[model samples]
Target: MSYDNNSAATPGYFNANRTATVTVNEHNFNAAEVNAQITAALQGSGVAAPGLGGWSTNGDVHTASVTFSADADYTFDVDYTDLAGNAAADYTQDKFTVDKTDPEVEFFDIEDKSANNGTVAPGVKYSDVNYMESGVDITIKGAKHDKTELSGNRTNIANGESIKMEDFKHDEETDDVYTMTAVIKDKAGNETEKEVMFSVNRFGSNYIFSETTEKFLDDVYANKPKDLVVTEVNVDSLVFNGISYGLDGTKKELKAGSDYTVKQSGGEGSWKEYTYTIKKENFEKEGRYSVTIDSEDKATNKMNNKVKECNIDFVIDKTPPTVVITGIEESSYRADEREMTINLSDNTAVKCVDVIIDGKSVATYAQKEIEKAGGKISYMIEGASEPQKIEAAALDMAGNETTSEMHKVLVTSSVWIQYINNTPLLIGSILGIVLVAGGLIWFFVIRKKKEESK
Candidate 1:
C-alpha cells in the first residue's frame, strides 16, 4: 500500500495507493493474453503515468504507480494500440493552468467639447484611456468625413485649447457649405468624432453724405447765373443784383433784410420759392450775401435743395461828374479839313462823348454812335486854320464825367511844286522852232539879196 517517493507513473493513472491498475475482462482477451498484450502496448507507445512508480502488467491487468512527499500536480500521457501493429494513440495534458488577464487602463477626465469657433484655441480630450498604459495606439482624427486628419497624435487635452481641423479645400463640384469635424483615437484604435457649423461674413467701406453734397455743389456751379451778381451768403441766405437792367427800371428788389423770402427760377424749367433772410448789417457794409433755394419740380415735386450765392455792390451818387483828362489829339487843322479825332472812355457806360474847342460845344457826339464809330469821334470846325485848344469829355450814365488833356494845334500852309522839263519833248520843240526860224530867215535873206543884185 506504500510506495517510494522517487517513482514514475503511467499515463491516465491516479495514485490512490501510489499505484494504478487497468483490468481487461475475458470477453476482450484472456488474462494471460491480455497481460502479454498490455506489456507490448506499454513498451511500444511513448505514454507514461507519472503517478505510478512505473508501468507494469500482470494477470490480464496494467498498473502504474507514483509516490510524492506532498500533494503536487503532475503531467501524464496515455497511448493505446490495436492488435494490427499500428502505432497507438497518445494523450497528453499539463498539470498547471493559467488565467488570461487584461491590462489596466488609466482613463483621463472628460473634456468639454470645444466650441468650433473656426479657430484653434480651446481643445478637447478623451477621458477613456491613458496613452502610456493602453495597448492601443493614440491618434487624433477629424470627423470631417473627407478624410481630414489632425496633425500630431495627442491624447491629453487642456482647457481652452483649440482643436484645429484641416483646411477645407473647396470642391468645385460640391456645395460650398462645409461641416467641421474632430476625431480622437485611443490606444485601442478607437476613435470619436465631433462637428460644428459656421459661416463667413464679408464687408467693405462706402461714403454716404459728403459725396452727395459735393455732387450737388458741382451741379449748381455748372448752371450758374450769368447777368446777375450771384453771391453766396451764409448757409441760409442769397443776394443778387442785376448787372444790366433789373426786372423793373429801378434797382432790382433783393431779399434785403433777414427773414425775407423770394421766388427764383429753378434750373429745370420751374419756378421755386425759397425762404431767405439777409443780414442788413452785412449787406450795408458791401459784404457778400448768399441764399439757399430748396427747389422742387412743380410737375414731379422733386425737391432739390440748391444753394445760390450773390453779391451786390450799391453806391449812391450825388456829386456832379468830375472830369479827368485822359488823352486828346490835335484840334486845329487845314482850312479844307474841318475835323479832329479824340480818344475818350469812362469807368461806366458813357452817356455823352463831346469835344470842346475853345470852350464851344459846336458838335455833340452820341455815346452809342461814337462807340459804334470805332470808339472815337472827330469834331468838325469851320476855318480850322485858326489855332485853338481842344478838350474832350465823357459823361457816364450816372452823370459822372471824365475829361481828356487839352491839345493845341496850329494850322500852316502847305507848299506846292510842279516839274515840266523832260529831255525828249524839250529837245523836239526847240529843234522845230529853230528849223522854222532858219527857213524864214533864209527866205528873207534871199529876197533882199535878189533886190540888191537887181
Candidate 2:
C-alpha cells in the first residue's frame, strides 16, 4: 500500500523548505551605559556574534538575525556581562515582547478652571468642567464678589472633578470694585484657577429744573418806578372847613365834594388807575377822609395781581369849637359896689364876655374890658336898687358859648341905715326911748316957767 502512491505524491516533494529569519531591529536607549548593557546581554545569551548569522552593528549598536521553528514557543535568559567578560553587578535584565497593541490612559479630561482672584461684576456666576477616574463631579464656590472679606472663611469652595461658581447678589452696599475666581480639578489630580475683574455703579433718574426769587415779586408789586411824573388832574391840596390839606407825598388827597381819577400818568391806555369819590357829607361829618391806592396792571396776565396800599389823609375843620370855663372868682358881693369883677377863660380864644343880670343883657361892658383886665370884666352894680343876681357868658373864636351860674349880691343906700336895719331890736329900742324922753321934758319945763311969772 505504501509503494502504490509513489507516482501520485505531491509535486515538488523533493524541493528544499524556506528557513524562518529572526531579525532584530535597533533598540531605543536613552543612555550609552544602557546600550552597552543590552549588547552584553545579547552576547552572553549564546546568540551568534555580530555579522556571524546572529547580529550586526555599525559601531556602538548591535543587531541580531535568527530563525525559529514555526508554531513553537521558545524561552531564553539574558545574562549581562561587564567589559571584562564577568557578570555585571547592579544591572537588571528586563524581559519584553512585541504584540503591536495600543496602551490605555488611566484618566483623561480637560482640567477645570481654578478659583480666580481678580475683579468681577456683582450678580454674576462662573463655572468649569472637570474629569475623574470614577466620573465628573462639580464643585461650587460663592461670595459677594464686590465686597471685602471680613473673615478668613469668606471663600466657599469644594474639591471635586467639576466646579461651578455661585451667583453673587448686588445691593446698595456693594463696592465698585469686584473680583471672582473659579477652581477646578481633573481626573489626573491636576488643578487650574482663573480670575476676572468687573465694575459696579449706581444709576439715577431724571427730573426738570425751575428758577424764581422773592425780590422780583416785591419789585413788581411796589410800583417804585412811577413816583415822578405829574398829571393835569393833580391839585395843590384839598380844602375843607377853612383848612388846607397837604400830604407828606405818601398818600393822595382829593378835593371835597369832588370825584377824581388816579393813574400812573400815561392814560387809560396804560395801566388802569384806581377811581374814588369824596362825598361832602363824609368830609363834613368826619372832618377828614382817607383812601388807599390799590390798583393793578392788566397788561401782563398773571394769577397774582400787583397791588399797593397807602393812607390818604385830608383835613377839614367842619367841627365846631368846644368852649370850657377855665376860671371864676366871686360867689357873692354887695350890690352897691362900683364894679363886679369876673375871671373867665374858654377852650378857644375868648371873643367876648357878656354881663347878664336877672335874665337881662347889660350893654355897658365891652370885650376890651375883658381883654384889658386879663380875662377879668367889671360891670357897674352901683345903680342896682336891691340884691340882684349877676352872671357872665363867654363867647369863643368859633362862636361857642358858655354861661356862668348867677351870683348873689346885696344893694344898700348908706352904711348907717344898713347897720340899723341889720341890728337887733334891743339896740334900736334903747336909742328910741332916750330921744322921746328928752323931747317931752323940754316942752313941759317951758309951760311951767311962764305960768309962775304971771
Candidate 3:
C-alpha cells in the first residue's frame, strides 16, 4: 500500500484549523476491507493523545483525516495491511506547524512638527486640534512585537518600528484633514491596525463682504452707513479666533449683537461661513464713517484691518442737499448779468443743481458743472414786464433732493425802466421836492398875478 498526505507541508505556518488527510490506493481490496485494515495516529509537540478519525474507503481507494486546533508542531502515522493479509509498510508525514497567536502592537504618541503653535491631546474618536499648517512633518512613535511586516497609509514602516513623527508631512495649498493608518501583520497571517488624525490648516482665514464697499456706497438709500458686512468667509481650521469690530481712527468700541451681529456655520476641512451685519443702532445719524474688522482662525490665519477689504471707508448721507439763493432781495426789480447765485451744500457730495423759473427748469448743472462752479449755480434774471417766480433745486450723492422756496421779483426790460427800478428811492425823493416847489409856485404866483389884474 502507498499513501499521499494532502495538508500543510513541514516548516509552514498555519493559523486556521485544517484537516490533514492520507489516501491509500489498492486495487486488490474493496473499500470496506481496506477501511477495516488501515489505521492512523497523530503525534506532535503539544498533542497528548493521538486522535484521528476512522478510515473510510471508496471503491479501491481508502482515506483517513485528522484535524488540529492548538499551536504546535505535528506529524501523522498511518499503518495498514495489504489485501493478501501481509503487513504493509508504515506511512509517516513530516511536522506541520500551527500558529494561532496574533502579534502585539502599541502606539505611544502622534505629534505635529510645524512652525505654527498648537497642542494635541488624546481624545475619543477623531478630535481635531489647531495651528497645524500644511506641508509640515509629523512623528509617530509606537512598539510592535512578533510582527513579520508593517505598512502605513502615508509611509511604509518595518514590523513594530518606531517612526519619526517629523518624517510624514503634507505639502499642499488646499486645506484638509489627514489620517494615517499603520497596519501590522505576523507570519501566521494575524494583523493589527492603528490610526492617527490631524487637520492641515493650509489656507488662512479671510474676511469677505456680502456687498462691496463701492456698491454699498452707491446704493445709499439703504439708509445706514455703508460698512463692512463680513460674509462669504472661508475658515478651514477647527479652532476659531473671535471677531472684532472697530471704527478706524477712533476709540469707539463696538459691541456684538448690539453694534453688530454675527452668524457662523460649517466645521473643520470645510468652507466656514460668517455673516456680520452692522446694526442700525451703530449709525445714529448720517455722515461719513470708517469701519475696521479683524479676525483669525485656530491656525492663526488672520483677517484684519490690514486687509484692504476688511477696512471699510464709506459715506452715509440720508439728508438732502441744501440750496441757498443769494445776491437777490425778497421783492426787487434788478435785471443785470449774473444777478443771482444759487449755492448748494450737502453733508456728502452734491450731484447736480437745477434752476427753475416760472415753474419750469431753465438750467441744469450736472456734477462736472457743479464741481467747476464750486458747487454753485450762477444765473441772470431775464428782464420781464411782470413778476417772475424763481427756485433752485439741489441733489446730493445719496439720492436726496432739496428745492429752495420760491423767490418773487419784478424785472424791467428797458434801460430806463432798469435805471428807474435800480434808483427807486432817489427818484422818489427828487419827485417829492419837485412837487412841493410846483405847489408853492402855483399858490404864490397865481395869487400875485390875480392881484395885479385886479
Candidate 4:
C-alpha cells in the first residue's frame, strides 16, 4: 500500500506550535500492517521521534503526526507497510514550520516641546506653553533575536531596529495627538505593536490687542471712511513669533503658501494696509462684527498647525448721514457775498457739514462746531460765476458721510442792473409824450392865429 499525503497541515504560516498534523490516505490499503514501520524526521534538524506511532486506521485512511523541537524548517517524511506485505520504498515528504509566539517589541518614552519657546511641555509652574512643533521620537529597544524585525510607518524593518524622527507637528492636518507606531514581527509572521504618544502644543497664544491693532479696529466704523486703510498683524513678526503675546513661542518650520495659507492681504510686515474685507451679510444685525481672518480648508491642504486666532471686538456703522442745503433758492440770482445755510439731519449725531463749491471744499464745519451751531452751518459765496455749483456733505459721529447733489446759484454782477434791465421803462414816459403833444398843439394854434391876424 502507498500513503497519499493530499494537503499540508501547516498551510501558509504559523507560530511555534512544535507540531504538524497530516492525514494518511491509504491505497490498496493498510488495515492491520499500519504499524509495520512508520518513521518521521526533520531535515537538517536530525530525527524528531524517528519511529513512534500507534497505528489507527479505517479502510484506506490513517493519521500521521510530526513533532518539532526547535524553530527550524524541515522536510518531514513518513514511511509504512501495507496489509498486502508490500514495503513503501519512497518517503512521503512535505515542509513543516515550528514557531508559536510573536517577537517582543519595546519602545522608550519621549516628550513634546512647546513650539513657542523651544521648551518642553508641562513646564515648571505651567507657564505659557503655547504650541508643539517638533519631531516625535519612537526609540525602539534593540531586538535580541534574529527572528525579530522592527519598523515604523515605512515598515522597512531590520534586525535590532533603532529609529529617531524629528518631524512631529500636528495641527489642522490631523485631529489627534502625535504618535509613532512601531511593529515587530517574528520569522513565523507574528507581530507585536507598540506606540509612543506626544502632546504638541499650539504655536501661538491669544494676546491682548496692541496699540496698532486696537487703533485699526477702533477706527473701523463699518462705513465711516470710504476705501478705509486696514492694518493686518504681521504673522512672521508678532503672531507666529509670540513676540507681542506673553507666551513661549518659536519660529515655524513650515513655509507659507506651501504648508499653510492665512486669510490676509499685503505682506508679512507689521501694521500695513490690507485688502481684507467684511461681507455685508455679517452686518445684518451688527453687534461688534465686521471682519475676520480664517485659514479655510480644501480638498488638498498641507497645514500642520492650528489656524491662528484673534479676538477683536469692533462695532460697526453702515448708514450714511443726511445732508440738505437750505435757505438758498434754486436757480436764483444773488449779487455776491451770500451766506448759504446748510443743515445736517441724521440718526447719529452730525459730525460735520462740508460746503463744496464746484467740487471743492470751500468751507467745512467740524463736529463740535456744527453741533454747537445746531447742525446748521453757513458758508459765504463770492466771486462765483452765475449758476455756481454748490454741494453740502453731512458727516455723522459714526463716520458716515452724505454729500448732497449740486445746486446752482445764478450770481449776478449787480442786482440793480438786472432789475432795471427786466422792467419796462417809465409808465410816466407816455404821460410825458401826451403833455408835450398838447403843448405843441397849443403853441401851433397860437402861432397860426397870429399869422392870420397879420
Residue range 1-454, candidate 1, lDDT tens digits: 2223212222322223232244322223322322211111121243333333444556555555433222223333444443543433333433311111122222222222211112232223333321222323323333223533434324443211223333333331221123344444333233445544322101100111233333433333211121222221111112322112122134333443332423343232111223333322322321122333332222332222231112222332223333333333443233444455665554334567777879877567776786786556656544443466767777755445667777776443331100112335567878999999999999999999999998
TM for every model, in the order presented, reads 0.24, 0.25, 0.45, 0.31
Q: After superposition, how far is residue 161 of candidate 3 from its true place, in Å?
A: 42
Q: What are the lDDT scores of the predictions, listed in order?
A: 0.36, 0.34, 0.56, 0.46
Candidate 4, superposed: residue stretches over 4 Å from native:
1-12, 15-53, 66-75, 82-85, 109-160, 166-177, 183-189, 200-454
Model 2 alpha-carbon drift over 4 Å, by segment: 1-336, 364-369, 416-454
lDDT of 1 at 366: 78
In TM-score terms, which candidate is top?
3
lDDT of 2 by residue, 1-454 (tens): 0111122112211111112222222343222222222211221243322221344555555543332212111232233343544442442432221111111111111121211122321221222222222322222232223342212112222322222223333443332223444443332233445544332322110011111212322222221111111111111111111112233333344442343323222232121112232233323332233333221122221111111112233333322323223233332333345465666664324667777777888754445665677776656675344456667776654445667767665455565544544445547777789888988898799989999999
Per-residue lDDT value at 187 in model 3? 45
**How does candidate 1 score on lDDT?**
0.36
Which tens-of-lDDT digit does each residue in 1-454 have in candidate 4? 2222323223533454444454557667654554424333333444444333455566767665545544445555556576676776675565555544455444433532112213322210000011011211233221111222223233223333334343334452222223445554544555556664433323322222345555756664445322222233222322221111111122223333343233443332222112333332323443344332322121222221124344443445567777778756765454656667787777546767877887888777888887788877777777444457889877775677788877877566676543443324444556689999999999999999999999
Worst 10 residues of 3 by lDDT: 124-133
